[model samples]
Target: MQAQIENTAGKRLWIKLSAVAVVVALAVGGYMSMSNTHAAPDVSFTNLKGEQVSLKSMRGKVVMVNFWATSCTTCVAEMPQMVQTYNAYKDKGLDYVAVAMSYDQPNYVVNFVQTRSLPFQVTLDTQSKLADAFGDVRLTPTTFVIDKQGNIIKRYVGEPKFAELHALLDKALAT
Candidate 1:
């Protein structure tokens, strides 16, 4: 009878410990999900026109920062869409900046911008500081969508689907 009681007590303890473990696991999971999105680093960019633009100043606006290189075909192909996206949302409080990689020739970028008549801000990362600030971005056409609150909402490593991107922009702008 004593052995039976001891066994019952042990089983109850085991169940209680298991419940505590589960609760802890759930709490950790929730915390991780909540902390997934991080704030964008504060950085300044010099546009082609030699105007200084700081990310901190862009607060309260949905900003799109694209890291691109002139030699990248994909970057070239998606630029038109980027222009369209900027044109579509610029008046709705969206700010866009295209950062040419440090390796890209300034003349090439200037010529491309002039030929295309790109309306958004075009900046050159000549010292690569901007790239390092943006998570050491090495791939061409890497894009980051920052929410109005200055948190990085999404990152696209390659060409993003325009439709989905538009949907995300619409949702973000609505708020």
Candidate 2:
């Protein structure tokens, strides 16, 4: 009876350890999938004013290249925070540009911009070239924070954590 009880207890411990291992594996995998860091691809899109703005041209400044769509409520919802983030950091060598996804209609983008009185550069990815350059951004509200050296320091798929973003910006600005 004693031996049987010990074996049962060992089996329970093994099962618990296996469950914990699986949870740890999944946590690491999820984090690895989300953290995509790379060099900011060189590309250009037509700004609202019809001038071409290139990511390569903004190499010396911290740039936030955001891919968004008018149809995405989350994208629209985050614009105010984005604007505030830009306004707060622009003077410290931060450059922000919002790129309307290729699937977004130009009229809707224009209307959104006008209604919001967006202060930063708003551009259109009409040809989808810019999207392709930025890892084929098919998701609205995807944002990339590029350092002054043109490396993408962070990529947020949805609304970013404003506090953490501000911290990253602080570090990026100091560089």
Q: Which of the numbered candidates is closest to the native, going by highest lDDT?
A: 1
Error of 1 at 18 (Å): 4.2
Worst ten in a row by lDDT for model 1? 32-41
Model 2, span 53-147: residue lDDT tens: 78899988999989999999999999999999999999999999999988899999999999999989999888888888888888888999999
lDDT tens per residue, model 1, 1-175: 9999999999999999999999999999999887677889999988999899999999989999999998999999999999999999999989999999999999999999999999999999999998999999999899999999999989999999999999989988889
TM-scores for all candidates: the values are 0.86, 0.78
The lDDT of each candidate is 0.95, 0.91
Candidate 1 residue spans exceeding 4 A from truth: 1-31
lDDT score, candidate 2: 0.91
Off by over 4 Å in 2: 1-37
- The TM-score of predicted model 1 comes to 0.86
